[model samples]
Target: MPAVFILLRSLVIRLLSSRLAGSVAQFLRRTISTGAAHIGTALRHVWERIRSQESKEAVLGCVLCILNMHKKVET
Candidate 1:
């Protein structure tokens, strides 16, 4: 999935920069910043801490709590 993002980002930059000005380079500086739909490696993250193990555990805990399945999830 990360590979796919890299390929798509590269392709977008290639095509846009070819027909546009250097302003197209701004695309690289853009980031997703928020939202679950675009979570993971498909987009650039502002920081690794945003998806850290602690955060993952928190999310899993919330999901389990919501579903009333607060049981051990074996890793």
Candidate 2:
């Protein structure tokens, strides 16, 4: 999850500073920030669920999911 966030943030920064300009750049910034905020909220909910889950296997699965998130996004 952290890796995914880093990848997304880097992409957004690169796009905002390079290929985007004027109102389009501002729009993209706002859109990406809003989307990131929403994802953060969702992640908090997921964290809560993971904490409440007592099964070791379930927790491990969640960890694995996060670790592999970047790979999934790449493809």
Q: Choose the strongest candidate by TM-score.
A: 2
Give the distance in Å from residue 30's predicted Cα in candidate 2 to where it truly belongs: 0.0
- Give residue 45's error in model 2 in angstroms: 0.5
Would you list the clashing residue pairs of candidate 1? none
Model 2: per-residue Cα lDDT over 1-75, one tens digit each: 999999999999988877656768789899999998997788667776764456656766886788688784545
Q: What is the C-alpha lDDT of each candidate?
A: 0.64, 0.78
Q: Write down the TM-score of every candidate.
A: 0.27, 0.43
Model 1, 1-75: lDDT tens digits are: 999999999999998878676555455334434343465444234334456888767766765587687666889
Which whole-number lDDT from 0 to 100 does residue 52 have in model 1?
Answer: 81
Candidate 1: segments with Cα more than 4 A from true spot: 21-75
Sliding window of 10 residues with minimal summed lDDT for model 2: 50-59
Instruction: In angstroms, give how far residue 35 of model 1 lies from its true place.
Output: 51
- RMSD in Å for all candidates: 16.5, 16.0
